[model samples]
Target: MDRISALRNVEDALRAFEEGDVDLTEAERRVAATLRTYASELDGEDDVFRAVGDPAVDGRVVVAASAPAARERVLAAAGIDPDRIDDEGDVPEFDVERV
Candidate 1:
């Protein structure tokens, strides 16, 4: 499947798990597949999508350091415009002033 489709599937699986509707094994399988596909689509040599402890609705892949910078990096790595990743609703947002 395409990267977007894989991402959506991963998100859905995580949502199901978070809501207590899916099991750990199923979630893991979906996450692993999604990560693999995501990594394959990475055009940047240093791009990496490391999984944090868990997934959430606002975000699935948590950028490892400096949330704002990481957010931009994540967007860039995913071929998305850095200006498009929404952070208004997420806690510890992508706001540079708060970083």
Candidate 2:
């Protein structure tokens, strides 16, 4: 979807929430879906991925060439330094799935 379309969709979701037509959870879901659609449409050769399994990186959406790259992108976006790990548990454990 185009940027304008995405904005309109998000606005609609917000309006529904304001109008009491949908609950907060439903409105959030609709907004997320619209954003995912917009991101996927704008993604070129790479694919859009969502991070899962870890609290720090969970729900992060990014466009990457591969799953590994996507995870790394999420980590970076979350201010996580993979190489600065103090121990095995220091690194966030998450999986990037194509969205």
Candidate 3:
């Protein structure tokens, strides 16, 4: 499937899981499979950026360099205050392997 379609599937599965319509295992499996396919499609790009957000809230993910400014930009784009990202232990859930 295309990246957009695959992501949509992931989001759907996540929503279902969140609403208790699906089990966590099934939801994770669907997301993993879709992400694997999508990642393969992006095979030759520079993977030098990362963005963090709760998929249960936002379905889209974006990447940015690890530079302080870039990280702040990404956090802001996700509707999170960069200064508060590390404060109050509000770390956003993200997969390190995917990053």
lDDT of 3 by residue, 1-99 (tens): 677798799889999999999999999998988876675455443343444445622333344334454455555666778565665666455432134
lDDT tens digits, residue span 4-97, model 1: 8887988999999999998999899888877766655655333433423323222445334355555565445446664554776333223221
lDDT against the true structure, each candidate: 0.57, 0.89, 0.61
Summarize candidate 2's per-residue lDDT along 1-99 as a digit string, tens digits.
999999999999999999999999999999999987899788478999999988988999999999988988998999988788686587778888988
TM-score against truth, every candidate: 0.35, 0.70, 0.40
For model 3, name the residue pairs that clash.
49-64, 50-64
Which portions of model 1 show Cα errors greater than 4 Å? 1-8, 45-99
**Model 2 TM-score relative to the real fold:** 0.70
Q: For model 1, give the RMSD to the true fold.
A: 10.3
lDDT of 2: 0.89
Whole-model alpha-carbon lDDT for candidate 1 = 0.57
Model 3 Cα shift for residue 69 (angstroms)? 24
Candidates sorted by lDDT, best first: 2, 3, 1
Error of 2 at 30 (Å): 0.8
Stretches of candidate 2 above 4 Å error?
52-59, 65-68, 87-89, 93-98
Which stretch of 10 consecutive residues in model 2 shows the poorest summed lDDT?
85-94
